[model samples]
Target: MAGLKIFGSDPENQPKPRQRFADDVVGRFRAGHTIDDRPASLDEWRITTGDPDVAARVYELFGGEEPQEGAAKGEDNIEVFTAADSVAIIIESAKSLRQRMVLWGRSGKPIYVSDGEFILDENGHPTEERDPDADLTFQERKEKKDIGAVPDIDLFFRLADDPDLGIFLFKTGSWGLAYELARDDVQGALEQAEGPVKAVLALEPVSFKAKSGPRKGQTVSYTKSSLTLKGAA
Candidate 1:
């Protein structure tokens, strides 16, 4: 498989939050093996599946404390992520692509997103359906909330601890499962594992510069580097 060039704003202009996330993602992409970013055509097919609800699964698998303020009283808190540690991911898509798949009616193409085991309603009632894109009523958001959607520090370690779904970078193209990079090695403090497992990632689109002035097209690509697994720290 060939690699795709990742384009982004100037590093200097990127906020700390974005830069930190991007560096972490790029570092993982470069870990354990020499990887290259080559130019290729954009993949028409794509899949995304990291729901906030499933965030708790990460904390449960790893070790971390949840936020104190929002957590229900007397409930044991799990450490995951906080407003102080939130990260953002930005992906590139042509208007055509976005409209065709992500938007409604244009083609009604299916977009893959996360669907956890449960859902919540106002007053903390459990619900049967888990609709990722269902419009949330004001009451639903005000009272009904999913504890699992929130992130915690524990999620990092869980990825490292769990064998089934460890820290990884998963990419899919037209057919399916294009590439997956799971980092099991923790190198000193730079990549230390605080718990039994750890996983973090930043995902985005690959970008490139056009060669010619007019009408010349650019390309995107995806490639698998190497997979490494070090023991718990």
Candidate 2:
């Protein structure tokens, strides 16, 4: 908590970096994360918006090359244009998003519900003949599974509507913020996010490796590296 507070203040006091939290939902959306529900002396909005290495990796995963010179020149800091509210977050990477959805669907924690759709005939109208390509199965067809854009969209929606905590929503534009692997705190967060959409984080760990030799069992290491978050979603 103290770390987050310190982090929040560090960014605010500086000569507004090229990337500051502008009062735009796009900015806010760009710098998206769950609202800090925990009590603290001061509330600091967590942001994750920079890191060339992370940007390169995320870009690679999302089907784009790293930005060239001056790519993020003006958009140094995020601009939160809209107030906190329910919003649909669209992750642009089709392959990566699909792979993550499969991961979350298997987790069984943040139950992923499939949305039902109508069976249309060749004329593009609902017909007695069921469309073989419909997403909904017979069982799901009876109930609209509340399906939306992509898996991340549904996951973010669930996070925002979490009963135990509340989170704001944001859509991905251009390229989302990237985090480097820094400390155990961030790693732990990633493990927890195994269930659904994870927060936008950036960590730059000097070194990271499994504690035990690579085996046929789950393994992990520990660290206490400092974490620096740049911005939201």
| Alpha-carbon TM-score of each model against the true structure | 0.19, 0.19
RMSD of each: 22.0, 19.0
- lDDT tens digits, residue span 104-208, model 1: 233643232222233444433447755453464423432333321211111121223333332323222221111122122123222343333222332324456
lDDT of 2 at 164: 23
Against the unseen true structure, what C-alpha lDDT does each candidate score? Answer: 0.28, 0.29
- In terms of lDDT, the poorest run of 10 residues in model 2 is 94-103
Over 4 Å off, model 1: 1-113, 116-127, 131-222, 225-227
Supply candidate 2's per-residue lDDT for 176.
12
Q: Which 10 residues in a row give candidate 1 its minimum summed lDDT?
A: 92-101
